[model samples]
Target chain A: MKLLSGEIISNEKCGKGLYKIEVFSPYICRNANAGQFVNVKCSPDGILDPLLRRPFSIYNVEKEYNVFSILYLEKGKGTKFLSDLKKGSNLNFAGPLGSSISIGDRSKNFLLVGGGIGIAPLYFLARTLIQKGKNIFFAAGFKDNNFIEWSGELTRLGINYRIFTEDGSWGDEGLATDFVKENIKKYKNYKIYCCGPRDMLISMQDILAGKKISVTALLEERMACGVGVCRGCAVKIKDGNGSFVYKTVCKDGPAFDLMEVIFD
Target chain B: MIEGSGINLSVNLGRIKLKNPVVTCSGTFSSGLEYSEFYDVSILGAVTTKSFSFVSRAGNPPPRIWETTCGMLNSIGLQNEGIDFFIKNHLPKIKSLGAKIILSIFGDDPGEFKKIAREVKKVESSLLAVELNLSCPNVKEGGIAFSSMPAEVEKITEAVCKILEIPLIVKLSPNSDSIIESAIRAKCGGAEAVSIINSIVGTAIDIDTFKPRLGNVTGGMSGPAIKPIALAKVYFLAKADILPIIGMGGIYDWRDAVEFLVAGASAVGVGTANFVDYEAGKKIIEGIRNYLSKKGINDINKIIGKAIC
Candidate 1:
């Protein structure tokens, strides 16, 4: 479906410049999977000033309540408009888009890593794995205490998570990268998923090189026509033939192997 | 034939005909594959494909899109899987959908355009017309857009017309030095119609990092912001009374479409609106019908050049 409307259940500030909006959309709850996204129209009804729809990863989907949540930072005009939307107002979007995650080797435990707003999609992944009777450990890192309240989301969801912030204001004082490095031996065999800042993803790519662990990174880019047509969110992938071809992050993946992605 | 409205919405581009006057811009609607998931694309007058080529193409790198106040800047460097891929994959699907198609093709030069037009000639029976894409701003082919030069426009149009049995429509640019000359030249080259205007050349800068937002540093701007400029261009060519004009640029709804028609456009192209609402085309089609019914105008052709008169 191209345009789906959802009513805002709650839109609240979670931390410094961070927001978590829950929307009531039975269609999305039934259709969307972890790692997919919804492209939202940020402006008010009949307003095309903010002309493009913003793509946000499906942060969490609560099937029981027929609701999905999005965690975003007040980054730009679009996010600002989204943040200002009042509760019970209708939001229009086109979604359940992008590639769904292919959770491989269920027998292996799950290791989820997130940085900043990248934690949004990981929450849904953790929730899905937990429901599937999998053992998952979520390791998240933030710049400061920016995502302080977001940590509460994991706690409320009963996810086993370790928090790391640079300022030590929120959790353990260190980088999530360092934590992953410190705990690599213990979780090397675990199925891993990471989403975060590009710098962090680059670092994760470097750290996980030749570790023989399955890792998927959710990528975000400035995109138009959240479907494959526009070729806006194209990323180079190392095809099996050792050469690279341009693959759209929207269609081929917002989820791809950390090793296969050539992030320039 | 238009349901109960008693309005004759059917229109003629040239030797060919369309059930309605609304079409999708090349590169924006993706030959109607994705949009077909939302509505029956047969409702459209025609579907113009993204720029066709003799060989497949890979578009620009990431950060190809940047949003502005009332529009967007995109540098999607015409990525497509060539004509062979389109014929084997998209053409059959479009045929199945039972919608008229216009093949919009681009080339590095007139010779290359002639080559693609020859291939198009093989499938001309399936297409309503051929659209020559002479003014895409993103690619660095020959260092600038071909439509910028009037002589090149006439030369390319004439070359393609020789091979194509179907009517030819020349797609022009707002960034051209003088689109009037280009349109006149296209008419001289035996083109049956012209689609104006392609995205205007523009740029957006990231304030945080103080760097260019698009990976290509510049892109073509489209949306409601360019509507007035498009209206002026369409009005000009229609007054020139050369060939039929297909006007487009930020047409969002039926009102925008009607504005283009009143300004002397025989048809309108829906571009950026497809990205905003999947049902934009459907709504515009319905809206045009309702508008015609309400105004007591029995024929859509009656509205063309009304503003110019």
Candidate 2:
């Protein structure tokens, strides 16, 4: 991975508490892959207030223009500071960090599941699989219709997708995991890839396990160095010897087999 | 005028000689594998591996770290894969890097410390020294307990010193009532050097949630915020003339490293700075060379304790 300065091409509020920031950084975009993330230095140079860089998944990449976008929620001080930046502001970021999802066997059908902001990386994966002429299905959940983002892009790509919202204001009045359970038998032959809140992922894992369907889930944790060095962002995974070992989320995976993970 | 390449950055920490005075502090650098992507690990004086014990540790749970004013607090609980894993998986790669290796060992008591040290001696040959991590304030046992008391510090040092062939450097905690006394006791116990000022015990509370920010409730604080306190400790240790000091705490740049040197550190370690910049150790090495060349001081040893005498 390389540390490069990315100039903001545009920053817009895409939905409630959501932002889509597009940056022009050839160094990162050229090498970035699906499921990888960038560690952004949110605070300005010489200011160490929010000392650590925040990690955001690569939402999309436009290689022709050497541009990439990150989808994030204005959750804390670091992200709030990020939202205030105008067009053409240069931000320092390190990427394309963490292990990418295994595309594996393009001939196999793919089913993608995303929840809230977790949809960020899944969008990139969907785009990639669609371009390869692979049959893809997307199932996403937001708090409500007001929080939904990226459905239009999915339509433009001509990819089949389903949306769910908790308050019945959007398609399907239920949680994402409920939707996945209802549709599991229909997509029995497809390989499943999921990204969402920890509870959603875990519950979905239980549903998939009972059906004997394998899945890959993208995990998230508070991290210091988005590299393996600090041993921050560790998640327990079953070793080959049947014992659990702490694998760093930033390195060993941001994407791991749903079966191997031991969530606390 | 001294040539740029001719500046002597090598340092002698009693029995061990380092190519330079810039060592990656334990727990931050991670055995040189992670930072190797940025720069060669051998360029640093030595790479101190994360401290380990006889048994593998799972470490603390989530929210292990939290950001503070100018630094960060971490209670990683000395998370490691134990000594056997180090010998089997990590040591070969670290040895291949060609940097002087200093194994940081942590144990609850004197016998455990000796056991770990004995195992380390049989497997590794290129070790510059074994730094006894007696001052980690985060762990529930065997960390600050040994360093806080003078007699325990002496006992552990002497116990490990007896079994090891290489030099023993006792790392002392700044949280103690008398750091000087601790250093003196380490010297009396046959430690060749002492690396002072491990992170101070600290805590942070989330104003919104009205709860502790870290899962461990408290952790050891490090980064630019602790540099001044580290310098003062180094200055005090220098005044006592106990042993060669390997000083560190919140070192961010070359100027910070120099401050420790002038305060009387035979060598300086870069810790939290590694997180801010992966190549911080290399940059600090260059910065020290430039500072020495500009001042027309050809030898780095000449600058040690210059602030006092």
Candidate 3:
């Protein structure tokens, strides 16, 4: 992966404690994929306030304009600094990390399950899969109307989607996992991809436990080196040897089979 | 003459000499493979492999690392694939990268350190030196860090130094009041040089979870936050006129590296910067070269101990 700097096109506050930072980088626009991520230097050049780079999933890519964007929640010092970035300021980051996911030519039906800000990568995945003439259905759960603008963006792309919120202020008054549980039989032949909070992903894993459907999870963890070096961001995975081995989310996967992943 | 041009950046650390005074800290760079993807590993003086043991270890549980204000804490517990796997598989690959490798070894006891040292002696031709890691604060195998006890430090050093032909550098910690004493003991035990400051023992608590942030409860703290403390220890050893020192802690840029050199460090180790920028060593090397040349200095050795000398 290349460490390059791009001019910040925009850093907009999309919702409560949420930001969408778009940057102009042809390298990322050309090299990055749907399921990959970029580790951003949250602080200014030479400033190490937040020592490690923050990992953000690729929310969108506009190859035509040589730009890419990441959806972030301003939970810490890093994203707060990112949210304050002015237009034309240089943003440094290491890119196209982890294994990139793509769609199978024969697989026509695809379902995306996302929870809260976890919808970032799935949006990029859905946008790419739709271009391949695949039938896509998105079911996402949120805490509030934080994703109302995101739903508009999805509709603009003509993607079929369903939304769930705990407050019933959006689409349905329930959790996304509940929706998937009731409709699991209908999505029997559809390939499933999910990204969300740990409990939500775990709930989905339990819902599809005995089912034959293929499911891949997009995982996020606090990381130092976004490459394979540090051995810091580890997740338990079935190693085919009965027990499990700690696989780094930065390298081995930000994406893995829901069945192979063992959640504590 | 143009400033920063044609200046020598090399230094001799006791019995061994480095083309430059920059080395990656043990447990930070991990055999220099992942970082090699970003920049040439050979650019730095040497790449210190993550500490290895006689047997492979999976290490402590997650979350193994947590970022603080200007530093981070890690309890990796020296998770490595054993010395044999490194020598047979990793050494040749890193050697091919043209980077000088310093094998870092740690053990639960003196015997374990000697076993790893014996293995290093077998592959001495491939390594520049052997660094005995006596400062790891994560594991509790010995009920305490070897660095905290000067006697155990000497005992371990004496046993491992007996089996090694290459220069030995003991990596000491600043966890106790007897760090200089431990360094003296290391020097007495046959070590040619000392790597000042392994990470300090520190812990962080999550306010939300109301528990310790690290799964290991406490981990070794490293990065820019620890530089001042590291510089003092380096100066302490340098002032004591013991073994040559490889000073490291919180060194992020060339200015910090220069500070360590001025404080009497024969060499500087870049630890946490490699996490923020994979090519931090390469940039620091270039920066040092520029600093030396711009200041009208012709050799890096001329600046060693410049402040206190």
Best by DockQ: 3
What clash count does candidate 3 reach?
A: 4
Give per-residue CA lDDT, model 2, range A1-264, as digits (tens): 987787899998988768989999888778888989999888876677787788999999998999999988999889999999899988788899999776776446888899998989999998888777889888888788855555777677788888889898989888888987887888888888899998898888788876767688888887888888887787888887978878888998899988888887
Highest lDDT model number: 3
Clashing pairs in 1: none
Tell me the tens digit of each residue's lDDT in model 1 across A82-167.
99999999888888898888775555599889998888899888888887888988989987887766677789877688899888
Give per-residue CA lDDT, model 3, range A2-58, as digits (tens).
Answer: 998999999887788888889999999999888899998989778889889999999
Q: TM per model?
A: 0.97, 0.93, 0.96
Looking at candidate 1 chain A, the ten consecutive residues that score lowest on lDDT are: A99-108
| DockQ scores of all models, one per candidate | 0.77, 0.60, 0.78
lDDT of each: 0.88, 0.87, 0.89
Q: Cα lDDT for residue A187, model 1?
A: 85
Q: After superposition, how far is residue B106 of candidate 3 from its true place, in Å?
A: 1.9
By DockQ thresholds, what CAPRI class is model 3? medium
Highest TM-score: give the candidate number.
1
Clashes of each: 0, 1, 4
Which lDDT tens digits does candidate 2 get at residues B195-238?
98899999999899998988889989998899999999999889
Candidates, ranked, lDDT: 3, 1, 2
